[model samples]
Target chain A: METGTVTTANPLNVKAKKESKSKEIARKLLRSWTGVIGFSLIILLLILSIFGEVIAPFDPMDAQLRDRLLPPLTDGHLLGTDQLGRDILSRVIVGARVSVVIGLSTVLLAGLIGTIVGVIAGYYRGWIDIVLMRIVDVQLSFPFILLVLVISAVLGAGLTNIVISLALAGWVIFARVIRSEVLALREKEFITAAIATGVPKLQILVRHILPNIFTPIIILGSLQIGTYIIAEASVSFLGFGVQPPTAAWGNMLDEGKDYIFNSWWLITFPGIAIILTALGVNLFGDWLRDTLDPELKGE
Target chain B: MSDILLEIKDLGIQFNTGKGPIQPIRGVSFSLKSGETLGVVGESGSGKSVTSLAVMGLLPEKKSKIVSGSIHFNDEDITKLSEKQYRKLRGNEMSMIFQEPMTSLNPVFTIGELLSEPLKQHKKMSKKERKEAIINVLKQVGIPRAEQIINEYPHQLSGGMRQRVMISLALLCEPKLLICDEPTTALDVTIQAQILELMKEIKAEKNMSLLFITHDLGVVAEMCDRVVVMYAGEIVEVAEINELFDQPLHPYTQGLIHSRPTNNSRKSALYSIKGQVPRPEEIGIGCTFANRCPHAFEKCLKETPPIFEKGDHLSKCWLQDSKRQAVMK
Candidate 1:
């Protein structure tokens, strides 16, 4: 713009720019203590899920009647023992695998399905839009958890059923969110530019516009991980979740309810585990959403 | 005489709506010979752009349609081409630069990406070749730090840089016909001149025919060799640039010239036309501008004057006959 000193245009020198943008996103992510703390908790749980078997002092399925209902500060049971005589510490640690796997895979499947459905509906529009939206409408009419309950019951209850059920329950959020995003994005001049350049519609979606909306998806996905965990726990507690011997916190709670009055440690510890894991994921998601907002991008 | 590169004859476009359909341009005709510039000047709703867009096949079909038209480019009816074929023609044979450069360039993409897209699309150049072409286009457009700006997003650059980027993108393919729909309107005055200069340079370098659409008569004076002054979706006057400015035929043309402020002049309250542009619903049966014309007579009110040409100039008014009668006397 300042005339005279016009330098040569080099398109390939974009690596520095892309690197800086990524750094900016990372810097923004780390700006808050809450974001860092939430991130650490999620990471810690993920690590435990990955290596819980290697680290658990006693096998997650092992029980000792002699050690049953041991309170905190007892030897052998790190936190305490549940009414089932299973080590509560070991079970809570092992529950991370089910919760993380279900939460992540549900969101992954839902986000993939919903984003495709939404993009196709929004991009092509007209009859496709009407049909897809009508489907969305039909899906929306049912209470989500009830729908999940029916689905899991039909599929016969297991960890996989909970994953499929949670995926069915949550896919609508992505369909709605991404449909609107696509609607807005499709009309921009860049789209026309892309069209002029003969960029395929699918490429435009996956490459150009998808990157722009990923932050919101990540934020929402992270937040929903917590909700999915809680949902999985609820399903398990209702006798519709993991089929025992897995040491999922929800089933632990189901077994612990009998000892709730005399031996509160049984229900208390698993309940706390569920609460902490959900709280951790939700906090991280919220922080991610806040920081990723374009308005808050700079200093 | 130059060869006819883009020939458009009797082009009519309209918009379909709940109220049936509205005819924006009844029938418009124009042509762009190779290496020629045609300045289409008019008030906002004069169908100047609608006509160009119809020729380019870029109409937003939601509320618009080309009910009837034949656009001949390189001795072929472009209107008959499929959307895919039309796209093939757009960036390769004919590229368009839109008025708002900011909106025209994608904010998410780097200028380099935008500049190199057409090169890769039509030219099929490898990355290194495309990179060099992008930088060359940017340098030609007079963007300093073309390399730096190439990596920069649209938001990172100033308005002028964005406009230059738009220009670079347009010229990247070196199309034969550049349909610039008021490309300089959103720029600053100094930047406007710079863009105009850059456009002229590009036009000459590529030997491309340019269809420069604008409402500013001043720009017509500076950039056009021939001019078409439109009023209410009709071509009221067309002539060589010098003759059109010197002996303006249409009352609309006269009004536009008088409306421009001049240096060291009384300005005479800067004459403006008495009425607003006729809404499509309010248009009368005869001459669309009859109600607003100062020299309108009974005949002018009842009849639409056909275009009468003398040499390369044409005037659509009853005054030509009267002037001829006076000359005979």
Candidate 2:
């Protein structure tokens, strides 16, 4: 007995149903306080990063000698001017672009490299697994900061170099996490079915293995963004990232530290910005893990 | 013989583990004729699945090797086929449906995507042609709402529907030989009946040879033309379906037939063949089933029995020997 109604049903109906299901998930996510606050903060940071140039009240690089070290509640400067008499509010907003860019870029680069390495190692196994895993082990054994510093020093200090160095240091975690995920996933019956179906090894890795491990990768990426942001700040503080006049959060923090005692606005404002952004990314990451993880859903 | 689609002669598979090398399949031999359903019946650890995997060229490469024997498909010895050559044959000339339907289909893919994969890999067809072919096969397997079901993921369907999808997948390339390894074991009774019925219809319509592997004798009686009884990695008997049930020659085969619970025997305790199937490492020089056979004697314990043929029925037990039968009497 063939069904008459479903045969004539529009294919667009499936798309509509999928859209509604995602909308329902979004509504459920916003029901929790963590989701609401984390989402709002993430939105705020994204806005600040995108619209920093237009939104800043004064040019971040413009110096106002008379307005130097203006404290909170000042007329011209919102958060206050830094020791260089540059608008702290303007610089912080502009700094969002650098922090977000470096954090996002580092995560993307590292995740791409790590996921590829991990999938290859986990899928082929044998000597490839042993060799790749040994390399990961060697990298992980070194102090993370020292490795980054060495990489940064070799590449020379700049925005791109910092992202590169951070990604090099950061990828080990992803490689480790995804390799284990891929290892477990390779044993799944669908993979065997795919092999039995004559699917090429590369296609199976891309189509079957990659999609299944995406949730973990996304969760790991979001969490790592906070760490990368802090790392950029640390590297910049050491004079190895985002040179002066660009107003990156890390370099801004480096400049503000000298005036930490007297001009509290300098260090305080930048410090608060860094903390808030890191907090936002971390909170969003946690909520994402809870929402995206199939095991944790509906409970 | 000319119509034999696939034949395995003395196939042996050895898995090298850290403990030592263990031979899971030793001297497994059978032939599946064109348009015939050959059932390989065995309990778990009987090397049924391993033998099927070896046929598909899906065995774990680094750990296991084909220690002895040859698998000939359409006159070609597939055991020696390179990986690339096997890839061309797999899903093109032959395909397999696995035991666990729940885990066999990728969860992330839609039914349409899953079905389209084999066509894309082996067949040269335009997108529209592929879709039409997919819907045709899906409907042939008795899946309703073909268009609607295509867009749904594996998790959206029940176990029966997924198994149907898997069957449809295996049939997509129209492979000459279809190996069903316990395809209906995971389903309940009603669903199992429906799947088996569907498979029979498909096999008839396509004239595809089927290597049906299952431990369920009931399934073999319903599905098979001929049956191969494997015990502890060795074939104890091979017979036509009706003859094997009518006059099982080997003691092990007799025990298996008697062990089935019948309508009249339901009230009594079910007859069971005593002792577990021996682990691969535990097997020695004697007949593997000698310890469990009711008629096992000095010869059965000290030496292995060669396959004894009486007409078309073959049994691997000392009891099959005329001299041994006379001595026992």
Candidate 3:
């Protein structure tokens, strides 16, 4: 605004002003495509889990004698009624809540515990590394299923117990991944730089190392979610999951197991739900792994 | 001139593995004068790196260990110091620049963040002081627009730039000694010259002793004030750079000087040593280089040669007698 003022602009004005956002837009579009199918499936389950009660036509617990063994798309039963005359459609749709919750909780809990153990084992690395590694070896030696089942039994079955059992058993994966990452990163100049600068050990782990290893954690976490969902459903199907009449898909699966002989809808419907949900998550994880690591992607 | 920055007496580093205890460096002794640059030149696996790592107390606990050594630093025998004490000195009094700058610096941090890190940790400087220090260090390394560049990450910088950043990090602490471990091997020729010049300038500015470890003879000629040629974990030759280069003493040093690419013609194939440097386990009681030496006589194969001195130039070759006889004939 001042007259006769020779104004020299910032030298990096070209870079700062932004190159044609074409590359960014293209990268985003490319990244979004592979994740779309998985995202839709996840979003659908989340929506169904949230709105199960409000949207179901029948009171999920209501019984109709005549509607028993009704095939899918029959009058009043969109996904068919099970052997108990309970709505199969309502049960599977509501089953989304337990599956989604189990998937999220297991990952969150396991991830938190695993990261802490891994960082400590990796960072200090002396007798600490040796002792921590021994613990990991011992944990791995426990019959994985037996360990989870025992843990679950001791804790007593409910949503919380399932979450606890899963978290305890699943923590080692995150621990191992994060530990290796920290080991490699600890040798790096940034760590030396951190130490040279006198950044505290705790601060180095939390701020420096953890943020860098986040990509692998994300990829592994997504895959682990699929496994957790299947595990939750299996335990529940065995009658150890959500107690019956809770409208859980696994308990519905347990109820339908006996009648699976005469009527196919009970087992088929819930079984299909677990399979489809797990499949979607796995596909999503695959996409993320490929996207995050360009080496894995075919040119 | 006499104040010793580093004095290592009877230094021996051994690696106990499945094979046996591999003694790569045996009874190695040297003193680094304050504000002087000392070069440790050697073939691969000559224990040049191992010696420096041993001095820094940075060798991995899995395999490498100081079997016997007394490392006196600032009048204190620090070889017996604990990890905690060593860690305190590492980025402060004696910082090291590693061989591969690409893998040495963590790729995640901005260059400015990396540069300021030592200041923040050791000094606990305020944010303003940290920023100013980082800018100053970056500028000290001759990086233009260092203020803008400090915010960049390792991968964003070229190999030369990364090495400079490393130098800045090493020099940041105003350490009494800078251990440069093959610092320029990974860079291009032009970058190597620039880095060597930068190192010379910085060492002068800080008046710090430099323990320069390298395999390149040319680099030694340029940056080294005194040269120590190592072979199979022992000092085969030690003297002033010009003294050793002008009148090469050790047979190994003689071979290295002769084998330089410039010494050979365009059509003629370049001279390469006939065999690989022997691994520690494969080495016997005799002179380590005798098996590869063209002038090796029967005595040379059976007994180890002592470090022979003539003026400041030292040589460990049995050729001293046999070559003299051949010359007289």
Candidate 4:
């Protein structure tokens, strides 16, 4: 009996030790070089986006023809001006807000809709699954860019319209990913246990199914943000995304097209901003996927 | 019997596929008296798990349907009960634990949250009351660090620990009926013994009717008061545990007992039953077991056998008929 008590208490101590060791591993992971770089880049981009108005040397829309096409570090314009004489630096700074806002909104709306549809299709799995999955199939069949162009043309170009169209286009991927995940998740013994316990169907979906599929949802969502930022840039470049004078990264790239040869800085700076931000996001998302994966967590 | 806790009569379950309706369980029936632990033992495709699911009203809604049946619990017919009505009884009056303890719990929820769920839904206990109750039950189930373990998620625990948590979850509502479907199949032998011990202790204390389903006959011998032996979706024999071991009536039961590896036979070739269980589509009009039965006769092939009774034991075979037994003697 004494030995039994001692053995039982020892496991508790071991568990406590294991818990603290995991925390240490987490700390060690964040202290790695890639983690520091990725973290800093994301933090820096967020601050610039949120504080764009205060930090911009000039109003992003301000125009002075005399400063037009001036090279970087010329006079007050730190990054010079575009053909419209708008401060390139200010526009790039302000453009981060549009990318982040559109990216986040598109993902959130798409994620919510997809998760609901996927959960229903995966859980109930009869006519509802057939119809919902067929719809997803129909959405996936179309050329994505063509679909976006068609929707943008019908809705007319504006920020809200861009957001709405991207959401519509983006939700299919989320639905497909989440549906596949939930299909596997619903088969787990926990779900049967939940049903046997008489947890309400809705409660089971929310509390059991949703939480179990979150790992995939989060990884997919993080990766999609970077993709959506690029997607928004592409649509705006084609004149079917955010309208002109709004200083979206895509529109900036659009306006810089004519001055590609003479004023290379027009496209160069905004292009770097998009590339760097996308790179940072991708790096961070990849890191998260690896870190959260149980298979990889040991290393 | 007047004291019968649950009665299932003529339970027929069918799964409709693209080809046609495939019946898995045809006319399977049994009754459980109060505080009795009834073991339903069968091979893999014998429909033992399906019977338990039918009782819980948790069969897959799309593919499967209870074709014809009546399930009475405490004198109330539950066959026609709506899902909402079942909810009040489920997890309150009855609950279930399943196999594969490693994957039988939601990965994200802490043990405390999962265990407290039935209490929150059925008992309407306050947060403090629920916590204390949860801790007490965890301790009752022999979890050493109830408070610490409560905060831990399922993945953090070992397989045995998870199963213990599952048993605790099933017992939280003090359910009158507990359906355990191969609950220890996924655990190692040592853990299996421990879980069985825990279950025996708890069942004795609570006096709930346990419907224990397993493929292992040894488990039935150890845990059951009475045992039902199913073959090809039909009950072939039913008897008290000791009676079953003493004189198994049906050929399948006899075959099952013969296949057990006795200590003296360790160096000799083991006895095994011949032929696989026929697929549902392959089953013909006559007795489903006729194709596999060693005692199969012209009548056994030409007609389905009604259950033949002798004293308190029953066997579904022509050989069990008194006239046939008398003639053979």
Which one wins by lDDT: 1 or 4? Answer: 4
Task: Report the CAPRI category for model 4.
Answer: acceptable
Q: Taking chain A of candidate 2, what TM-score results? A: 0.93
Show the lowest summed lDDT stretch of 10 residues, model 1 chain A.
Answer: A1-10
Candidate with better DockQ, 2 vs 4 = 2
C-alpha lDDT of residue B169 in model 2: 95
* Steric overlap count per candidate: 7, 0, 7, 0
Note the residue pairs that clash in candidate 1: A6-B144, A7-B144, A7-B145, A8-B147, A9-B146, A9-B147, A10-B147
Q: Sort candidate 1 into its docking category.
A: acceptable
Pairs with backbone N, CA or C atoms under 3 Å apart (clashes), candidate 3: A196-B118, A197-B117, A197-B118, A197-B121, A197-B122, A198-B121, B112-B150
Interface root mean square deviation per prediction: 4.6, 3.3, 6.2, 5.1
Between candidates 3 and 4, the TM-score winner = 4
Candidate 3's interface RMSD, please?
Answer: 6.2
DockQ of each: 0.33, 0.54, 0.29, 0.46
**TM per candidate, chain B:** 0.95, 0.98, 0.94, 0.98
lDDT of each: 0.80, 0.90, 0.81, 0.87
Off by over 4 Å in 2: A1-8, A296-299
Instruction: Tally clashing residue pairs in candidate 4.
Output: 0
The weakest ten consecutive residues by lDDT in model 2 chain B span B292-301
